[model samples]
Target chain A: MVEITVKVVGQRTRRLKVDPGTTIAELLRRVGQNRETVVVRLNGRIVAEEERLKEGDLIEVIPVVTGG
Target chain B: MLRCSFCGRRAVYHRRYAGVFLCDRCLIKSVERRFRRAINENKLILPGERVAVAVSGGKDSVACMHLLHDYCRGKRCELVAITIDEGIKGYRDESLPIARENAEMLGVEHHVVSFREAFGATLDEMVKVAAQRSTGLNPCTYCGVLRRSLLNQAARELGADRLATGHNLDDETQAIMLNYIRADLSRLYRLGPGYSPRQGFVPRIKPLREIPEKEVALFALLKGIKVHLAVCPYASGIHMEVRDFLNSLESNHPNSKFMILRMFDEIKPHLEAAVPGFEARGCESCGEPTSSTLCKSCELLQGLGLMRRRKNLIFVEPS
Candidate 1:
């Protein structure tokens, strides 16, 4: 099992152990994060909810925003 | 007498969908036909270009995606589905799943771009801050800026040749009214089914520009597309009131919206020649295309500290 740590900007970070084949959507729901209110970036690249996470990936979940 | 599902007026015409009825007046300006006409008139899709449909899981967008997919099939154009997740909590959450389902069912490639990591803020956060600072300003002003910026960037990054939206007749008319009210002739001139490509920017095409809102709803129903039928929680207060006023006027005068759009079309030629080029120039700050040194999206993002503010915000007077 690949251990992945999820960190959200302006929020707390959490770690989870899962198979490398886990999709971003499943990981987000597991972390008690709302999929609509945030976007996930894996290792500095924006990954869609349907994208799967690989081993030792550092994921950053950001929120959707608007202004100006 | 049965009333229309849309306006609750006397039902005057039968729609293709069962249990759906439209007034004779509404049937005349049906959304499907309007969309077909818009595409025909504007030459929105080419023979072999890959087109990306922007879906928001709303009726208009879902209808647009389905229509474009069906229309482009034999035409040899590829249709990909793109959705922008604005991170509006419950509002955007429910819609994403529906959009994905629609894309999957259609067997089109689907991509989603979000604002969370892109800007480090959510729609909810922005609205909260805007409410505190600018009490009366509309949230759409911000949402529109961000969504357009992110969508354009995402589409380009995804290698889409053209970006398609579900902006229908009512939206075009409302925008025309707002532009006229603000004397924003430049923007008014730019409003249409197609936006010409400028330097460093990809072109955007709207196949539903001439379709009415009601017709879009009908098309969605007839096509059996599941739409996220919820109003944006932030679209209340003054902005909703303005839309309500316009809708009431449109209800009373069935052709009023189309008439307004016609006026815009009539004036477009004159405005195009007179107005200086609305080309994309590299942003001095972010290197994106803009009418000025910095693009509007970057300017707004910089204002929120999501991006570094490279240049001072220049407020152009609507000439």
Candidate 2:
């Protein structure tokens, strides 16, 4: 298992343990977010949803939608 | 790891609708190409004209300013920026600096008009009064009408040929759907890329209308641009609900937003014939262009007791 930290900018931060070879898409799904409303970054670099996670990987999910 | 479909570099974004992955460079290029295409295809701008961009310091507006800064150079167009301060204490105050910074960075002239100065009340104050008076209108209705009026007035005073706003594909689609739901054909007809010019009203143009909200935010991030990412406190309404519904639909069916936009475009021309002629006249209260005697802004202000009729003229009461 790999432990990862997901920080949702302007929201909350969560650390979770997941299986190896988990994709960012899977992580977001676990956290109740989807790709349509956010952009994901892994280790300070923007990444695609298909990018797999590594041990101690730090992911940032920034919600890009705003009203008004 | 996946590679960019075009350049074979490590991909950064998966454009699901297009079935392709893009690296940072390719993504930037793709965004720029589409922006130019939208402008050219719609003839949104003309050479040697001045465009006043409405920069609210958000990702979409900031990205629009930056892209227009570059695009305007080749076209020999002058770019100016206008930021409307709606007097939301924590929100608009925080964004004003970011908007100023980007305008200064691009050496574009920037102007700010506040709700307090124009309407004699801050949005917060107006909301309080509205609640106290039991006005059954949402805050967005007031903000939308007043802010749009301020943008037009500022742009016209600045001698801008066009007032540009940062409305992305998501916003456009949501508006389209909302108007459809409300059966407001007049507003639906006015949702095209360029609005027809009216006396006392500078025509508005939306250059970022084709790009999705996510891509605009991502473009700003990849280019190291700083943007204020705060959402408004008074953002809940039917529009927000529509936004969520559309987002979910787009998530399940890739290109759903694009499909809706395409369908709107296909049927938009017919809306003109159905809606009939619109005759714009100066509002009796504010002298702004409107289809009726009083502009929507003046009506909202009057409803909130922020303005009163005095000696055959409407004067804003000091709140």
Candidate 3:
């Protein structure tokens, strides 16, 4: 299992334990979030939800947003 | 590891739509290139022309302001930031400072226009009044009309040669889709990177038209620009649904967003001659160009009873 700190910018930060390699999509599903409405960032870099996260990874899920 | 399409560096963004992976450097270059190309191809701006950049302090508009400022430095054009405070209470109040900060940082002259000054009411008040009357229009629709009016009036008063907005490919595509669904051919005809010149109206331009929303945000991030991150409190309804739908479609189909935009561009030229010429006369109440005797802003205000609804549309011929 891998321990990673998850932080959603402008929202919340947490630490979680996950399998050796878990995709961001699975993490979002576990958190009960709609993948289409959130941007997954791993270690300060935007990544696809399909990105496989690693131990000690810092993850952020930002809501899908743009200005009018 | 995926490599940048142009550079040998490790890729940061894999644009499935284009089948290209870009690193931070290459990505920035690509975005900037698109920005310049949109302007050059569409002639959105001419040398020495002053552009009033509408900034909402969001990543999209702020990125636009910064990009245009940099682009204008060499092109000998001038940029001024125009931000409209829709008076959404918690919303506009929070975003204003960020707009000011970015304008100050860019050394561009900033103009903050308010609904209170223009229409004697904040959007929050407008919403309350509208709800009491049970108006058919949504808050976003009212706010959009008012904001567009104020932006244009401010830009025109400032003697700007053009008014530039930060609309991206996603925004454009969503709008196109909406207009298409509504069968609003005239509105669809007007959707493009640059709006042609019309008397009594400052031409509007969108230099970021070719870029995607996510990339605009990433460009802002990579440029170390600070922008307001909060979404508007009233951003619910059809627009949001359309945005979500298009986003999901893009995710599944990759280049679907670009395909929509490209398709619109192809259709726009054919629409030019077919779309009937529109002529605007001085609005009876606001004196702005309107096919109706009263401008949309004035008509809307009249609905709020903020202004007396003059029976002027009867005399005004359709444009």
Number of the top-ranking candidate, with DockQ as the measure: 2
Model 1 C-alpha lDDT per residue in residues B1-319, reported as the tens digit of each score: 4466678765533332234656544553465576677777788877788888889888778878988887888688898887888888887899999999999998988888776656667777777776666645466777888788777766776677889998877677777877787888878887988986685556899888876565565455444579876678776554445455565676445566777888888888888776777666787876666788887766676656566232221122578
* Consecutive 10-residue window with the lowest summed lDDT within model 1 chain B: B308-317
Q: Rank the candidates by TM-score, best first.
A: 2, 3, 1
Ranking by DockQ: 2, 3, 1
Q: For residue B191, give model 1's deviation from the true position in Å.
A: 0.6
Q: Which ten residues in a row have the lowest lDDT in candidate 2 chain B?
A: B308-317
Off by over 4 Å in 1: A1-68, B1-31, B131-137, B237-239, B308-319
TM-score of 1: 0.71
- Write the residue-wise lDDT of candidate 2 on B7-87 in tens digits: 999999999999999999999999999999988998999989998899999999999999999999999999989999999
Q: Compute DockQ for each candidate against the true complex.
A: 0.01, 0.78, 0.37
Pull out the clashing pairs in model 3: B17-B255
Fraction of native Cα-Cα interface contacts (under 8 Å, chains A and B) also present in model 3: 0.12
Give the per-residue lDDT of model 1 (tens digit) for A1-68: 88988998767877889987888768877886645335456776544455678778899976431100
Error of 2 at B59 (Å): 0.8
Candidate 1 colliding pairs: A62-B116, A63-B116, A64-B122
